[model samples]
Target: MLDAAEQYSREAFPSAKEFLRRLYDFEIYHRKTAPWNPVCVTGLPGGGKTSIFVAATRLLEDDTVNAGAGHVLPLLGFRHLTIEDERSELGILRRTCWAFNRQWSGTTSSAHEKTRLKEDDGFPMRDLKRARDTTALVGFRSGCCGVMVDEMQYMTQSTTANTLVTKSLLELSYLRFPFFFAANFNLVAKLLARPPQDRDRLLSNPVVVLPDTVATEISETAWKNYIRECKRVAGGVLDFDVDKDAESLVRYTFGLRRKFVIIIKSAYGRAREAGRFAAGMSDIEEAYKSTAYYTHRKDVESLIAMETSGKKEQKEFVCPIEVDSTEAMARHRMAQEEQGRAVAEQMVIDSLSPAGRLAYQQAGGPKPDAGEKSKGSGRVKTPVSSSSLLAGSDQFHRKRK
Candidate 1:
C-alpha cells in the first residue's frame, strides 16, 4: 500500500519526484556529515508534504530495519517531531534521547541508559533528570544522524528570551545532523528564519516546496491515471468511469489531489449502495452533494456563475455540474434551520436537571404540574418534542379506527 501510495503521489504531484530525490540526497549528505544544516519543506495543508517525507523515510529505513541488506547509511530515524516535543528544555532533552534510541538502540551506552531510565519507575527521578539535563546530545550524535520534524507550526515555547525549542534547535544545528522540517506553510520560518543575528544560520541551507494549488493540465491527467489504476487494483470494488466526466471530476474537486480522491471514494460508496456495477456521473454528482461541507460552497458557486455568465473571455468555458440556485437556497435555509433547532434543543437540555431530562420522553416531554412552576419565570413550563407533535395524527388515527 505504501509503495502504491508513493508511486501514485509521485505521478499526481509535480514536485513529488524531485522532492523524493532531494530527500534521498539529504540522507546521503547526512551519512557523510555527522550533523548538517536543517532542511525546510513547506507547502499548503493536505498538499502532500507529509507524504513525501514519510515515503522518503520508508525508502531509507527499509534497508536498515529489514535484513540490513540495503544501503547502510548508518542511521536515519523517522519520527513525527512536533513543536510540542520541546515545550521545555527538559522536554526537548527527553525527546532527543528517545529519538536517538529509536535509531541506534544496541550500539550506544547512552541510548541504553536513557531507555532504562524511561522505563524504570524505581530509578531516582532526580538522577534521571540530571543525566538527561547534563549529558549533551553530541555524545549520541554518531549513532543517529538525521531527524524529520513534522508539523513544525505547532511548536510552542515559553515567553522567556531563551526558549527551550530554540535552544534544542541550536544544539541540533551545531551537531551538523540534517533536520527535515515539514509544515503546511512558512512555519519553519518561526523556528529558523528569525530576525538579525538571532536567525538560525543553518536555515539558509535548502528548501523543498510541495505542490498544493489547483490541478494543472498535467496534474489532472495524473489524477485520471490514478483513478484508473485504483479501479483496476480494487477489482470492481469501485466502478468510476473517469472518461465519462473527467472534467467534472477535476473541476468539482477544485484541483486539490487529496480532495479529489476523497470525493471519488465517497462517490464509489454511493454507487455500491445503489447496487451499480460502476459509478456513473450521477453517482459522482450525488456523492459530491453529500460531502459538500468540505468545499467552500459560495466560492464554487461564484466560480461556476462567472464561467456561465457569457462574459467576454479569450477561451470558451464549460462547467462540470450546474449549480441550482433555487436548490442551493433551499439547502442553505434547511441547514440554518437545523443548526438553530439544535442550539434550541441544547439550551432546553441545559435548563433541565439530569433526572428531569431522563424522565422527558419523545411524547410531549415532561411538563411541570400546576403546583410546580419555573423557579425564575414562575410559569408552568411545557416542553414539547417534535415526535410528540407528530404523534397527534396517530391519536386521530387511533380514534378513527
Candidate 2:
C-alpha cells in the first residue's frame, strides 16, 4: 500500500483536460501555419501546469497519440529543458545547443566538448538559428519542434537573466518557433509588469491552469470524480465514505490535487501504523493534523486570505490573473462568520455558573435553542474583545436561555 501510494502521488493526473485539448488544438493549428506564436502556461504552484507540459511533449513525440500524425508530421526531435542553474544568456544558449546536438547526434557529448563548442565565436545562437531554418528544408525535413521550458520563474531571479531570456524568446518568436513555457503566479506577475511589447511577445497566447474550486455543481462533480479516482488507484487501501467526507477533505486540502494526494498517502500511512487495513475519516483528520501537513495547511490559508482580502501582502500568496472566485469567497466568509459565532458561544458558556453550565450541556451543549430568549436583558451579551463576534452571538445566547 505504501509503495502504491508513493507511485500514485508521483503520477500526473490530467486535472485540466479541457485546457489541454485546447492546447493540443493550438499546437496543431500552429504546425499547419508554419510560424506560431509562443504560448505561456501560467498557474499557481501545484496547479498541474507541468502536467500540461508533459502531455504536450507526449503529443509531439509520440506519433501513435499525435492527432496530426497523419498529415502534419510531429517534429523529428523536440527538446524539453528545465531552467535551473543556467541564469545567463550565454549559459542558456550553450545548454540549448548541447541538448540539440546531443539529441540529433544520438551520442553523449563530454563536458570538454561542450566547453569547446561554447568557445567558438558566435557559436550557439548563431548555429541554432542557422540549423533551425536549414533543418526544415534538408535531410528528413521534419525539423526541430520548438523547446518546452519549465520552472521559468528562475529566469526572473536577476535583471540581466530576465532581459536576456525575454530577448531570446523574442528572437524565437521572430523565427516563428512555437515554444511553450510553464510559469507560476510570481512569474506571471513579473511578465505582466513588463512593457506592453515585451509582455505581448511572451504572453500573447497565455493559458491559465487552476485547481478545482468545488463552488458549483460541475466543480463539485469533478472534485468527487477526482476523489473516486484516487480511491480506485489506492486499490482498496482507502475505505472512507466519499459522500460523507468529501466536503471535509476539500476543506482540509483547499481543492489542490497535490495536497490531496499527500493527505491520502499520509492517511494511509497513519492507518497502517494503527493496525488498520484501510483508512477512514479519523485517519484523514489525523494525517491532516500531522506535522507533515503544517506547511501545506499554511499555504492554503495564505491562498484563502489572498483571495478573500484581494491584497497581495508579502506574507500571502496572490495571483495576478483575474480568477472567478465569487462563490468560493462567499463560502469562506460564511465559514469565518460561523467560527466567530462558535468562539462567542464558548465565551458565553465559560461565563455561566456551574449549574447553568450543566443545564446548558444538558440542553445540548454549546448549540443554543433558537426559540428561547434571555430574561430582562432582551438581547444576548457580546464579548468586548471581539466586536466582530457580537452580531453572531445573539442566536447562541437565545438558544442557551
Clashes of 2: 2
Score each candidate by Cα lDDT. 0.48, 0.61
- CA error at residue 49 for candidate 2, angstroms: 0.6
lDDT per residue (tens digit) for residues 201-278 in model 2: 788888766666555577678889989988998899998877676777877787788899998899989999999989
Off by over 4 Å in 2: 1-35, 59-61, 64-79, 88-140, 143-147, 314-316, 325-401
For model 1, residues 56-125, the per-residue Cα lDDT tens digits are 5555441232213242333333433444433544545455555554543322224455456468443223
Model 1 C-alpha RMSD to native: 17.1
Query: After aligning candidate 1 to the native by TM-score, how far in Å is the CA of 169 from where it should be?
Result: 3.7
| lDDT measured at residue 33 in model 2 versus the true structure, 0 to 100 | 41
